[model samples]
Target: MFIDTHCHLNHERLRDDLQGCLERALAADVRKMIVVGYDGPSSEEALRLSLAHPGILYAAIGIHPHDATTWNDAIAARFRELARMDAVVAIGEIGLDFYRDLSPREQQYRAFEEQLRLAKELDLPVIIHCREAYEETLSVLAAHPLPGVMHCWGGTPEQAQRAASLGLALGFGGTLTFPSAQNVRDSAMCIAPEHLLLETDAPYLAPAPYRGRRNEPAFTRIVAEKLAGLRCLDLDQVASITTQNAYRLFPKLALPP
Candidate 1:
């Protein structure tokens, strides 16, 4: 009962051989995955994939902060339409990313607030992607209080506690398996189990054994295995806990038959 709370099945490699990817994930016991979007077109593609795959693949639609320059009332309206789709569960992978700063800081701020407002209005949970902008992200969340997961969380234990204070769950990924990710692991250790979520951010952060290779949902098991060690729990315990946390956060995730 594993759930990859964040991934990019819409990415070229996975989308090109989508059915095969699904089989591999299921074979690895991945029960569900969120195909996250970083832009309008990507959101549409994510939704398309989810609609096709139904219960197993779900969508989180939003423009990532890197693409915040695309923000506007018209685009906002279009995103609203997409949110209405059944398979679209949340408004995300959205938040600040000072590390890359691909968009103007001011533009990122505006787009982040705008999308937060949209999430507030639509009554949807968020999927935040904060990197080196934890405080800035917290500032935005302070203004708009919507519950969600901190997708790909990379903060200290204090920051993890701070995020938990704001009703957010910490997303632990392949980085947990990295020798240098003791910081992330420290954060994971401090976070209460109820505030933990497991994600692959697939086609990106593959766990240690597959690091540097293209990541896939099947590798989510590697992440779970690593987290199980960090938390001193068995693999099945970690899976059940994270899967329950995911369903609680994204209630729209259809249960498997």
Candidate 2:
């Protein structure tokens, strides 16, 4: 079985044909998917999807850094309310994104801190999205005792070590499959398997053969293949180990048989 640990099913790319997308995912042995939400409406949709799908789908509710420009007290309160739902597994898709700078640096930091506090308060793991701000993100996380996964990891081995040292897992995606992604590949090779989780970040980062195309949970197999190659392990071993790693990170998931 395979699990796409980070995906945005509520995005327009998949929203129109969610059932078909899920069916394709399952057909490719993608048994479970975590639908991550970056805002209020998407979070609500994610929770509703989880409720509708029961054991097949799960939700992560939080605000993304891109939306930090709109972050306010009312939005925070709404996120808190959503986090209380049984179907909501984590507070995330949240963190700093200096790459886009869509939100002011100060606002990004404030939004990231508030959501981290909420996750700590709710006693739940966070699913973080960090880009070009590894140091800042690490600094913020260090200030609190929070459990989380750094989704779409793109940092130096030293940074990967730093994140691991702080008890956060590193999420690997299609970027690892790119021939030009030596940094990501090297980090994946050195990171502890137990602290590694696989994700597609789909409708986005599609792995090789599927690259430049619309990504889906099914393409996670390509990620597994690349990881297996990088670690010199068999495909089954890679799949088994990473699936277990994902289950460990998101214990709320109902693993398929």
Candidate 3:
């Protein structure tokens, strides 16, 4: 079975037709997914979506670097409560994003480090998002020493190796399928299958020939197909390995590990 280890099905774009989306995913053999949150409301929604779907979905909660400025005591308290919930699998879709820099750099560091400590205290794995700040992100992670995925990894070969050295899996999604994404393919080829996870980042980076369209969990199959092609492995092998990797990273997934 293929697992979309990252997505945003809880967001408004897909929430309205979530049932249909899931059905399509199931039909496409996309059996499991991780719904991510970038803030408090979305985190709660992710938890709810996971509960409703049971084994078919799990939730990763955190305030994304984009919204790090809003990470106050009240939000932290709420995340602490949410962290303990049954459906919550990880503390993430979190980390640094210098590309957007929506939040002040100092605030991003504060929020990232604070959340890193929270994940350690809660004993939960994390799902990280780093863009244009791979070195800085790795430095922070080196200090905290947490288990997480570098969600949507688009870094260089050296950074990829460093991430693997840190015991972090690199998440690959629709970008892998882009005609201009040979670099992503190269990185995917170098990473061990055990240190790899698949995602759609749904309502976002949809794979071609579905590019520019609204992405959904169903398109994760397309991403998997692309990875299979890159790895020169059969689709079943990619599916089995990546699913195992996802389970290994997020033990809170209520399924066979």
Candidate 4:
């Protein structure tokens, strides 16, 4: 079985056809999925999905860097409350996105720092979303080390080593199959199996042949296959390694029998 460590089934694109998506994911052997939240409403929706699905789904709730402007004392309390719920596993999809700069840099840093503290407070791992801010991101993480997964990692091999050294697992998705994403491939090749994870980032970053199309949890199989090919390993090996890595990063994902 494979776990899509990060996806957004709560998003409108997939939620509109949620049942079909779930069926397809199961068919693809992508058994458990973590629906990550980028804001308040989506976080609630993610928790609802996890609660409704039980073993089949889980949640990671936090404010995305894009929505950092929305972060505040009240919002933090609400997220703290949500984080304590059984269905919620982590404190992210949080970090810097210097490329878009959607929220002011000041707010993004503030939100990222505060959320990092919150995750530390709750003793939960994090799901980081970094884009064009590896230096700053790693620096902050170094200052406040914690276990987590760098969702949809697109950093260089050096950055991959740095993240792993800091006890962060690196997630690879459809981008691993992109022709021009050599850096992602190289990073995947360099990271140890224990630190490797598979994700679809579904409703986005669909793999080849499915590229340019809407992504889904089913595509996690494609990512696993690609990672297997890149690592000169069997599909099952890749699946096993990544599933264990997912469990290591998000302890709550490993549901009771």
Q: Pick the lDDT winner.
A: 4
lDDT of 3 by residue, 1-257 (tens): 88898999988999998989999999999988899999988988999888888888889999999999888889888888988877889998789999999999999999999999989999999999999999999999999898899988798877888899999999999999888877788889997788989999999989899889999999888888888988899999999899889889888785542
Model 2 spans with C-alpha error above 4 angstroms: 255-257
Tell me the lDDT of candidate 1: 0.89
Better of 2 and 3 by TM-score: 3
Provide TM-scores for the models.
0.97, 0.95, 0.97, 0.98
TM-score of model 4 (CA atoms) = 0.98
Report residue 210 deviation for candidate 1 (angstroms).
Answer: 0.8
Tens-digit per-residue lDDT, 1-257, candidate 1? 89989999998877887888789999999978899999989999999989888899899998899999998898889989988877899999889999999999999999988898999999889999999999988878877888899988888889889999998999988999989888899999988899999888989988898898889888889898988988899999999899889889998895452
**1-257: candidate 4 lDDT, tens digit per residue:** 99999999999999988999999999999999999999988998999999989999899999999999988899889988988877888998899999999999999999999999999999999999999999999999999999998989989999999998998999899999999999999999997789999999989999998999999999999999999999999999998898888887888888562
Q: List the residue pairs that clash in candidate 1.
A: none
- The sequence of per-residue lDDT tens digits that candidate 2 reaches over residues 1-257 is 88888998888898888889889889878888889999888888999898888777889988899998777888888877877766778888899999999889898988889888888888879999999999989998999768889999999988998899999999999999888889898889887888788899989988888889988888887898888988999988987898888777777784441
Query: What shift in Å separates residue 181 of candidate 1 from its native position after superposition?
Result: 1.1
* Cα lDDT listed for each candidate: 0.89, 0.87, 0.89, 0.93
Poorest stretch of ten by lDDT in candidate 1:
248-257
User: How many collisions between residues are there in candidate 3?
Assistant: 0
- The parts of candidate 1 lying over 4 Å away from their true place are 255-257
Q: What TM-score quantifies how close candidate 2 is to the native fold?
A: 0.95
RMSD of each: 1.2, 1.7, 1.4, 0.9
